[model samples]
Each structure stands twice: as C-alpha cells, then as structure tokens.
Target: MNAWNEKYLQVSLLWFAESARNKADPSVVTKDDQEAYLRQARFAQGFIREEEPDPPMARTYSYQQPHALPKVQRAFDRTYATRGTQREPAAEPFATATQSKHMDHGQPTQTTSPLAPQGRSSGQIQVTGQWDKTPIKLSFDPDASGEAFYQTFFQWAVKRKRGADLDRERTTLWLKASKATPDTQAYDLELKEDELEELWNTAVEWIQENKNTKAPHLYATVEMEAG
Candidate 1:
C-alpha cells in the first residue's frame, strides 16, 4: 500500500478512538453502536486524500568530465551559424528610383540558425561529449495562454535547430502543453547541461512578454537533481 493509505488508516483509528471516548454514557454503548463506529472507522480508513505530487528536485548534471561516443552511437551536435535575411520586393517599378530612402541596406542580418525540417529522421550522428549528469524538471502554470506559451516556446526551439537526436525517433520538446488549464497547467522541461542557461533565459523572456500584466502570478521553475 502507499504511504497515504497507511496514513489514512492511522487517522481513522485515532478518530474512532476519540469518537468512542466522547460518547455521553459508556454503559449505554451497545452492539449496534459499536458496529456503526467500526463501520465509520473502516470508511475513514479507506479514504484517500487527493493532493498533487511533490515537484521533482532540480540541479545541474555535468557530463563534462570525459565521455566516449562509440562508433554507430548517437551524440549531441550543435553548429552555430548566421541566419540569412529576407528582402521585401518593390511595390512599383519606378517608385524607388528617385526616393532618397533605399531598401535592402546591403547588410546580411545576423540571427540564430533556422530550425531544420521536423519530419526528417535523425541519422547516425554520434553524441561524442558528455551531457548534464543529473535530471532536471520544470513546471509552468496551466491555462489557455499557458498552452499557447509552451507551443510558441517549442516552435522557437525547434526552429533554432535545437530539436532532434540521432538515437531517438522524435525529439520530446515540451512535456504537457495540452493539459494546461486556467487553474493548473503545470508543465515540465527536462534539460541537459548545455541547455540549462538557454532554457532559463527563454522562459524568463516568455513570461515577461506574455503574461506579465494580467497574470503576474504565472511562474516557471528550473530544477536540477541534487548531487
């Protein structure tokens, strides 16, 4: 049995004892009274309190020490590259000839790399380096806005070439986006070592821009296992 069931049994026994003691007349207590008391005790013993499970502990897991990625094994790979820019086409043929303001400033904008295709299979890229050694979990508020918030975050991450692994069929991005209710849409994000800082910054920025004014109580937590 679970710890909660054990606790309920103990509480029921105590309540039964107290109820019996509080009876007005000890001599008046009869067989029916005893049976009713026992039944009540049994019912109470069967009761289970409903409560949320404790959030998982968070801490950083360092895989930086030295690790090997064997041949045919999958490893994490990240390549930082400049994201290209797009130019708007001219509205009319001769409109821009005489205008002092010029478009397409001849500068290549620098941005994070675009996300790779989502449906493509992760090939046999090996994970050569170690990752965070400990597990991490995070929770978020649940609501319609929360659902949209996580979806945006996932799309942002996926678009940034950060969502895929050679060993896994599909990268798991956000854990519980669909279940975010107005009251309780807590979600979890598990991260490896290098992703910790990036994830935290993204979450902070998201909260500030999206829910700061009306839902200031909306919050997120970053957790890592205790070492």
Candidate 2:
C-alpha cells in the first residue's frame, strides 16, 4: 500500500486497539486473548520500518568574548587673558507684510473653531476596526482537494474585495479543516471585519456553484474578534 494508506491503516488499527482495551471486560484477560493482542502488535511493528539514523554531528564553537577598557586620568591647565569688553545697540525692525497668498484649497476652511474647556479631556474620534469569523463548513467535490478550494474562494471573495483596505504588512488569513468522516469535509474561513460580510456572501455563492455532486453543508458564525 502507499504511504498515506499505510499511515491511515496504522492509525486506525491503533485507535481500534486502544478502544478495545478501554472497553474490555475486567474478567477477559485470558492467555489466548493476550497472545492474539501481542501477535497483532508485533505484526504492526514489523510492517512499519524504523526511521533512519540521524547524520553525524558537526563541530561548533562560540566566538563571543568580552573585553575590558583601560581607564586614564589627565589634567591640563590653560590661563585665559582678556584685553577689554564692549556693548552694541540692537538693530531696528523692518516694515514688511506678514500675510502670505498660498493656502490649502483641498479641504474646507473653518471660520469658527470649537473652544476647548480648561482641564477637559480631548474629544477625538478614534476608529478601532475589528473582524471575526463564525464557524463555517463548506463541502466540495472529492476532486477538489488540498487547500485549493479555500484559496480560490478567498482570492475571489475576501482578498479581492478588501485587498486594498487590508494592511498587507499586518493582515493574515486563517483556515481550519476537518475530515470528520471519509465522505464529509468541513472548512472554516477566518478573516477581518472589513472583509467578513463580503467573504460570507461570496462563500455562499461559491459553494452553491462549485458543489454539484452532493449538496454541501455550510454553517458560519463569529468565532473570535481581531483588531
């Protein structure tokens, strides 16, 4: 069998054996039963090859070192001699215009400015943008595997709409997938608030269009909030 099939079989058998042990009756520890379990375990170990040994170690050294500086003290004296001191009168101011012609025209000019109260807090509007994802499950045909489905959907839905608004330097997208059963798959898309609504609507349309074989299930709810 292939590596994936082998791994799946091994894990499944291990889980089955563990469940059997947990649910086994207290009175059923017969010699025959013990022998059968041991034989199965041996067969599993023999079927799975041991991993290859790691490579030889390489020589390494720490080159960091500290140094101390020498302290020195020296004294030199010079004598200052002054001949005389003189005072001069200040210059008179020139009669020039103070106003300039250039002014910003893009924004509206304010005639009356709001007065601030003494010892009062500044009333500035601070915008705190946030986004979150509800638990969403989307199903696709078996042919559409890996992360391609979610990646494609996101590129068209969330990324396209909010690509400009997103702080590419700080933005991130998270996806969670689950294969609860061999035939069923679920995917959850997590994104920021500015793109959440667009993502939701686009996802609904995408699932409806792409999933033709079997009617896929989709459930979305806010999981957590991020700023």
User: Highest TM-score, which number?
Assistant: 2
> Which stretches of model 1 miss by more than 4 angstroms?
24-29, 41-227
Segments in model 2 whose C-alpha atoms lie over 4 Å from true places: 1-139, 158-160, 163-216, 222-224
Clashing pairs in 2: 131-193, 133-223, 134-221, 134-222, 135-221
Q: What 10-residue stretch in candidate 2 is worst by lDDT? A: 76-85
Candidates' C-alpha lDDT: 0.42, 0.41
Candidate 1 residues 1-227, lDDT tens each?
57867786787667666766787874455686679777866675445323435544679897775664653233332211111112324544457575535746676656699787764233211111112332222234332243343444345335544334211112223322222323244434444434433465665444444442322233333233543
For candidate 2, write residues 64-141 as lDDT tens digits: 765433331111111111111112122212111222234557766768877877541332111111234322333333
**C-alpha RMSD values across all candidates:** 48.1, 52.3
Give residue 60's error in model 2 in angstroms.
99
| C-alpha RMSD (angstroms) for model 1 | 48.1
